[model samples]
Target: MNTQFVVGESSSSSPHLSCDVFLSFRGEDTRKTFTGHLYTQLCQVGVHTFIDDEELRKGDVISIELDKAIEQSRVSIVVLSKNYAFSSWCLDELVKILDCKQMLKQIVLPIFYDVDPSQVRKQTGSFGEALVKHKERSFGAERVEKWKAALTEAANLSGWHLRNVADGHESKFIKSIIKQVLQEVNQTPLDVAHYPIGLDSPIEDILLLMQSGCEHEVRMVGICGVGGIGKTTLAKAIYNRIFLQFGGCCCFLSDIRSKVEELGLVKLQEKLLHHILKTKDFEVDSVAEGVNLIKARLGSKKVLIVLDDVDHRSQLESLTRERSWFGSGSVIIITTRDEHLLYGLTTSEIYRAKLLNDNEAQQLFSCHAFSYFSPPQEYVELTQDIIKYSGGLPLALVTLGSHLQVRSVKEWRYEFKKLKAIPHGDIQKILKISFDGLDVNTQSVFLDIACAFHGCYEAEVIETLNACGFYSESAISTLVQRNLLQRDWPSLVMHHLVQEMGREIVRMESQDPGKRSRLFNPQEAIDVLQGHKGSENVQALVVERRALKGVKLTTKAFQKMINLRVLKIDNLYISGDVELLSKELRWLSWEGCPLKCIPSNFPVEKLVVLNMRESNIQEVGLDFQCCRSLKVLNLSDCKRLRSTPNFRGSRSLETLYLDNCSSLKKIHPSIGNLDSLITLSFSCCKKITDLPSSICQLKSLEFLDISSCSSLQTLPVDFGDMQSLRSLFA
Candidate 1:
């Protein structure tokens, strides 16, 4: 009996080929029984095998097409029966097969169906009889030569010869072939390790760094490595260990790249101030002012600071200066990828992050993939194969293994084939392998959140996604499951890198560049707000583009935004139009806006904070009289301003920042009325002379930073009245 093979048909809509195995067999001999059984067995094992059943046109040369399919496949299976050599078309396919074997190094497996090895090799018995007719036909001798060579090669190669095997034994034979294929597939390079949970070498190294103590002026320790190599994790571990030991500590995980991209270094310095000083309203006018403040205030404290994901040397310079700027016990730990940055820092000590070994990679993969310390019994063989294929890379191993965790035997086989052939550098290949395992809707949700919405409110995302016709709570759940998106209390945050990848995918899905919605651009943001207006689901608006002229605002827009809390509009060209803002607004930034002055009737009392940095306003006007309830006022770079607004009567002003009002020479002595003031910053007011003798009236002040006021010499005699001040910069 001749063994027959059939090729699977695929849809044209999906251009990418998916099958791992392509089976080639002559149909006439075993179309109804043996070949059919073999195809079923292949599918049952999840082999994703393709066998052709559709008839080929007579005299149609399928050589080129078949060769292309063979190249696309990882392995090719040939079923040999007695009459297989009779067809000239089959002979031509065999010729291409030998070519594939030579050129592409394609894997080929031959199965003999109740045919003697001698008969196949010499074209004897039924094979010989079929060749005689070909010998009598056109080009018979040349055809015979090729057939004899193909049979010889098939006979000599390693293969299974079934002699009169019954249908009951077919499963055993198929299983044997599967075992061999899986064994070959399982030779992947993976690392496996066994150790107590939550204990690693990096932890010990961090402890040692901490114990070394900060005897030098500026003790800087840098932890450098690639992304996902556990740099942040290690930094967090260290921070947790030592946070209680220091008198003051702050960890900033801001994305330096995004911050520098959105607001220049000068603005980032202000942000750092807000974090370090423990106030949101603080700002610094320039890098020079920031550096001076750090030296004068944090200079003598035994502080512990962790700057995670530091990408630029300038960021480091602007943040931490000489050892003299910090007290003897202060420690600063920086995590980054650029060794050059570490070398450029004022400190000398550095540690290079290394990739995990095989044992560690396997353990990490197994924990994520199988949700245990080891692979389950049923998937042990396949898990070993997956680990090997991941090549000891923990990220790939965990990503792929997690994808294959719940799949069946056959599914694993199919996945193994596809994964083996994928290019190593294809991040999508790794991510998709995991993503495809998610339910279709969950995949959609992941892609949407990863692409369009990040650092967005959870309730808003759910509502927006649901309104857009994607109602998949399960998908959102799956995203959280896969660590693609995280739910932080009420908001959803995507890792910066994952969001970037998601946008890349979304960009790939669209051809029109203008249709791409940008979260950063001011005009694009306005369009988004307009599109979703009158809906209570909107929570935050980050505007980076300048608002257009004559843009009208109505109470309806503000009234509907009951949940809105943060309204950031930088580089806006404000007009004289009176706009009623939501009283519920907690954070507002109007940097680089060209407003001549704030609205006289603006409700400043309800505002918890206000930032008007880099605006063209020459004066704060008497509008400051109504801001009795304000807590933070940032006027860092309002260069056109010639005087400080009188805040001596404002009792609720807890934090005041006026870093770069260089033209202002005096502050109203009535500033002493702010007894509730806890933090005050005036780092770069070079023309300022003396602080109010009444400044000592601020008995609640906790931080007084006046580092770069070059023309000013002494503080008020009553400066000691700030008894609660734990931090001071001169």
Candidate 2:
């Protein structure tokens, strides 16, 4: 076994190794002085040492107890102080301990305090004179000879010499002893995860891949996965299992990707060299120098190195780039989120880590939340719900479980309800690392999908995002590869935890709605509007649910939103003085709009999209002066009377939806002048309609849906100019 334990290495319950160390000191010589301090230091470091407490026990049963103590302890610490040989009780204990050491292969450490080892070995000074006093006592000569032999053997063995090393600092001396003994007692590798469910199978698979079978060959293995998927934990376990066998020169370099930015490559290279070379003062001025030193010095030594969470190829180049960097039989293992970093490496193997399975996730979560595998009888159903929401991600499961562990059931219900809207902060912090690594444009697209278009069709989301200038096609692919986003058939599906992280990014913009980039909370929105706190910072405002309490606002409510772009206000009823919607607005989706017309004076100069579906509108807005940028205008389900507006100058309009407009009457003569029009929908518009001669001018229209227009009479004669039209619904 290695001298130091890694995290998560639990001790086996063996009776023979029950006591960690047995303390043997002469009571009259050093019991109250050096030995007492040593025993206290051992206890502080969590060693199970058997120190003889003279104040607690009587002299009658002392010998029997001392014999049992030495028998159970795995290590015997014999403090050979001056006058140590004077007591028959001490000599008897020493003989028994030395016999156990030979028979059981137990560890023995002797401390020669203020006394020479030669004196103890030859029995010449204080020890020899004490043996003469023992000769006149009732003890037999055979017993005295046996005591002399035990002392000679122990003093000859290499051990701590206090007079030569301590320099009058007894505390420091005691601490040094504790350090060595602590390592011997707890030699675990790493604090393995709290619940290592489904851990053995993956580690076994990695072990198979790591097997090179020949001492002349070197092996490099990669463990790849998304963030919080337990890649680091698995890598540590693998390193702990086989690291001790690799000539005792091993280094576990963790957080390579995350820490390199804070602790530069030069520092990391220095650490790798120092750890594997077993030197403290090794120095290199630059990363290149460090790299050279590592290659030159460690080339002939068989080393084991675990490079954890490597995001870039440069980190590999500096640490362990090629198999020739180390001696034969050396092993190099790397854990990373990007598998591309190991693409062209020589003699490489990859292990793809996956999220925990359902059973494993439940077990892992139970360990964190309830201190057991499975919840209490009363919390069974609730714990299962928590597991389903976690989607088998171990980080999410453990984080959520820990958060709800000490809370009452009622509190759990309340917190779980809140999580449906905003995720747990600790969970978001971990998942956000993947999100934070994206570029600005990709991050914007992710936030859009997370906030509004999560369940929307992929095509529609792409079209809308393209119109808003967010390049999402490649960004979506990147997200999918990172396991942050997934695509369902019609709509995109993001893990609930990942989606919550995206929302959290927007939430962090500002607590006040006016200063936020996006506003979704109903109360915050109402407070912003009623208090006239709206600012130009807001880009999107979505009222997902109806107004809990009706809010009152004025015309100035939205006058400050100079940079507002998107609005999806389907719910909250904000009634008061009408405000001129911001001219910078691009996408306005106000379903069930209460107004008949959005007042012509409300300039929509930069509007790219507009939807007032299911409103009480009668006439189209007469403001064509500043609407040259309009791309989409949907008046669907507007029951009131309406007539199509004449388009003499608003040429940028692309999509026109008049579906379910029950009272539509006339088509203006210039209705066909929309040269940039792409989609035209007149479905369910059961009003009088006749083809305008100018309709054939829409050469760019791709989709034309005129189905259920019961009153339509004749088609345009020269419609052959509509060559770009792909689908027709009539």
Candidate 3:
């Protein structure tokens, strides 16, 4: 059943009208063919119809009763035929029908029966020749113009097109027409979100951007946002609000991203033309031909087109390439997850679909979960927890909220625990598509952040990962654009759910603690370390701040871990004759090393970053070894340090942080040759410092920090020789 007939059995929802349908057609044209069958179907279905079949004789005037019937009818069905306009009586009747439509605000449906609507609209073919005859008969030029205007107006309406739809089967066409009739008569509302929240602002913003100084100019607007952010809903709302008011063709092409594969681009193009032109079965065998056809046909008509869920720029290239493709006052709206997809589109602004705020999220979730605007007192706290995890994403909120509706509060608590452990499948499935779209290297970077580096500095993560042999420098921007990562002024931020999704992916690698690629949880790390059950597959690991008491690791604990690339274990308790770290290790951050110095056997050629911030272990190597690839080395707060390392082999070093190494220090004159260094920090090194004249030779250095050096210092006379310097902190 059509949604329109959801009320009383197939009747008009309005009770103020007298007759159900008023049929206006020519007796010789469609009285026995199309109109006759239509009337039979209407009457058989209990539709009270008032059709004036009384033919006036030659040169006889039409009775006033015919005019009365047109006035009393709720709907006027105008059937346009080849010879229908040849009769003066039919033209007079059409004029009266249109007048009643304006005065009574009646519903009007037009059926093009065996006649070209274009011929009727532009007064061109048989209809035009007949109108010329009417003029020759001196029916008055003004009266003839009125008849032509009425035909144009009626043909433009959304109604049946027989030649395009029903070439041979009239019965099938009649059924479709009746379905449309019922749909038109229906007063039922459309299907949309029950509680649409946080949409008014975006709608208002987009509409403002889409506005032109003149209504006669074609305008295009793009809505860019991530998945599950309600772009489609916003587009639908905007379409519903302005579609009918345009008095032209309106089309909303939805699910363009997922549907293109099945329906093909050519079919979508055909549908676009058919819906706007009020035709059916319009065929397009190729997208190229469809493009030409659309450009040729829709150029003169004002149209409202909303292309929803567009995932690629190619879709836009094929459908709406330019403003000139449509007539004046036309509007084209597109929605896509990638803002770059809308890159060169001719629009002033793009509206980004924002996540709901706290109150709105609560209310929306409540509607789906509790079937109302608020939750029960018992489940309020649990619902808040779920909302926090959802982070204002509409699809996640709705899905999780609805899933918890039938469960008890205790069950909600249990389900919340499960959601925290593993993300809701519905939410994760959609989010994973973004992850799955990336290449292997970018996916690795994303998982590294999710599992180990969520709160770390963005630069540090990028520099460290790039050192660890994962290309993260450009991938970060891609993740940010995809909405998986957000920039928080100085640091990077990942949604908690997205982070969990990455963690869950890592967990799926293996159920055993030692078999995973990375381990972040304290228990998992502890189990793997204490049991000496490490594996080569565990490439990265972080056992952060707190610990289960007394867990220890021997130096040989990492012997089996040949593939480890990153290790950041802070304040961990471990002591042993540590001889070897895997040769693959690139960045090592051990805050509290129980050993006196870094293991001599640790590979230096591959080591890119080494951080021992706030650690015990005074002396660095007397001479920096073959660490040719080292870009960053942070030993901030190494209180036992007495001297800087030799700069013999540290030429590639870019950033060297020695902040808060409060013990006495003496500079190595060899440090002056480090021309590749960009950032060199010596803040809070309270010990004495002397001049190294060669330091002035570092022309490539960009950042130099020497704050809080409480002891005396002498400046090199030629320090000003460094020309590439951007910032010098003294």
Candidate 4:
């Protein structure tokens, strides 16, 4: 029996449905014969059905209890027997059922028993006679018209015609009706989320993918994103929306990551088989056996499966390894943080879940905190602050909103202040799961990014990190695949809270700043530096002048931080004796240096990036003669009197920027021997300049810019011989 059905907007939108089916029929006609047998079968199949078996006398209107039953039922089965319209109670019940069909979008299936569908729809024959008798008995003309309309609407619906099948056999007809009713009732919607904000667009997108020309083939779709970004929620919503279309052979294996740990793979495989096959009779002793059973039994049955929170590729291998294991038109959905786990799926089938936008985040937060779509007027700014802190991550918003609920504005202010200092623990716990899954080296790379290099370009960061003995390129790809890091073109982006969590992890390593791997707080770095509490464990530190007023640092501050790989300080005054700094330092950004040159004793040969955009340096000379590893040297806007350094030893330099260095003059002749130079820019130098005849010998230079160099004149005779140059701005 074909029992596939669709619920209208009203039905799907109604969250108050209490019963599966409501029977509307006349007690005098086929109630005991046809309707009673159908109700018995529905109960046998575990369908929650409502039948009016009471002996109450017929009246002009249905009882209030009956009224509620019709409104609460998800599907109302109306038995239009020969005498169904003869009773006023049956007509009243039919009228109420039809009302629910329009208002609540309830499923109303009318079974035409022992009567012509046209006769019932047109109010002819027994249906017409019953209506005429009701009018003659003064059942109210307006009420009679409502009954007529209800009968016509119900009869016109697509439902069972008893006489058209099984040659009018009552037993066969009742069995078919039960089967259809059971199928309709078994399609229960899964609970997706409490708020379910920003899910419609993703669900729509996935649905379109499923419907895009591959309907006849089994398709595997992957929903991948970082933890707490609503991948599982989206998968559940999509499952709820389309599971019924695959009949009852659908199973949502939730928390597959944890469930696999708690109950072995065999249990999960059993769940798949039991849910689809609809019986617990099947038993498998091992995963291999379960796989065989799943393939042998379900190969011909179309199914819909959602594997939520799948982390390991092995979990997928043991569950939905191949598409041909199920019947054609089947759809398998997998939600994971690691996009790489979905190996066999095509790009079109993999959906990377993104964080919510401002509007969506606000609505979701407001829903949880205020129990409304928006916050109150007095809390709008506070709400926006929370949303901004959430970084559009739905989990953060939900957690923050829920924590702030029922608190006063003053309490919210205090909580926000604390939150700025530290991420909420609930949010951290979930975000950390992705980080915790990474290998140690990848974890180190992620911590570096979160602690210091979040907004830095990927290429620049990679060069520095790679110089520090990290497998940067591969680790970055791993982090990106796991959704912990976002590759925003050249720059890498991380969620604000994830960065906070990483920083917090470093902080939690020890109470003393000297012991932490990274220090971003100015006061903490000052304490560690001035107190002689520095340690080799501190790998990165930043001290912005804006955060610390009139802070002075001695070169001795770096005496103990031998492992420091990244150092970024802005406008710090240093006037004490110089000490040897970290030999491992690779990236150094001192925006406003107060020195004539890098401290003479400082070790910088390992430095990959030396950015001194605006500094007091007098000249670029022999201080960097041994810095063969330098890849990028940014000395822009260094207005002090200067000349280009002799590039005898900085052959590894790939980019040299001298933009706005008005005092800069002369290109050192040795620059021709710097075979690895890829970019050289001196835009706006406005100083005495002439091309070195040997400049054209930079065979590896791909980009050369001399725009706005007022004093610059003449190109090399062999400038066109710089075949590797792709862009030249003169």
Best by TM-score: 4
Q: Write down the TM-score for model 2.
A: 0.62
For 1-730, candidate 1 gives per-residue lDDT tens digits of: 1111111121111112346667777788766667777778768767677676455424634555565676665566777887787777777676677666655445678888778777887778988887787788765677678777887887777777776333537667777777655433222211112222232576666555545543444467788754555566566655544443342234444556457767877786665555455555566788898888778777667666777766666778887746677777667888865455676453336776655666676677778777787777887788777766554545566567667777788898887886554323344543443454456677667765664456655754564456445675666765664446668967888654455455555445434323443233345456644553423443345554356344544334445555544567666543433345655555566787576666566546556567788778776754555765577777887787777776645766777888887787778777777878888888888988888787888788899888888989787886776779899888
Residue pair clashes in candidate 4: 11-105
Summing lDDT over every window of 10 consecutive residues in candidate 3, give the lowest-scoring window: 1-10
lDDT: which candidate is best? 4
Per-residue CA lDDT of model 3 for 1-730, tens digit only, reads 1111011111111223467678888888888888999989888876778777655423634567777777767678888888988877778878888886665556788888888788888988898899899999898999899989988988888778887786747898888877766544432223447677666677667667766446677877888776788888888777755553344377788989777888878878887887777667568889899889889999999888989888776788788888899998788988877776777765466787788899989998999999888789988888888889889999999999889887998898888888877788888887776788778998998998888778777877887788777789888887886777888866887877778778888888998979999988777888888788899899898877756445666657788888888887777767764446777877777877665666555566777778878878766762355787787888888888777777886678888888888884787778787878888888888885665788888878899888888784677899888898899777
Candidate number with the higher TM-score (2 or 3): 3
Worst 10 residues of 2 by lDDT: 5-14
How displaced is residue 557 in candidate 3, in Å? 2.9
Quote the lDDT for 332 in model 3: 91
Instruction: Assess each prediction's global lDDT (C-alpha) against the native.
Output: 0.63, 0.77, 0.77, 0.83
Residue 386 shift from truth in candidate 4, angstroms:
1.2
| Candidates by lDDT, descending order | 4, 3, 2, 1
lDDT of 2 by residue, 439-484 (tens): 9988988888887777766765665677668887977777775667
TM-score against truth, every candidate:
0.35, 0.62, 0.76, 0.82
Full ranking by TM-score:
4, 3, 2, 1
Model 4 segments more than 4 A misplaced: 1-18, 22-30, 33-47, 52-187, 623-625
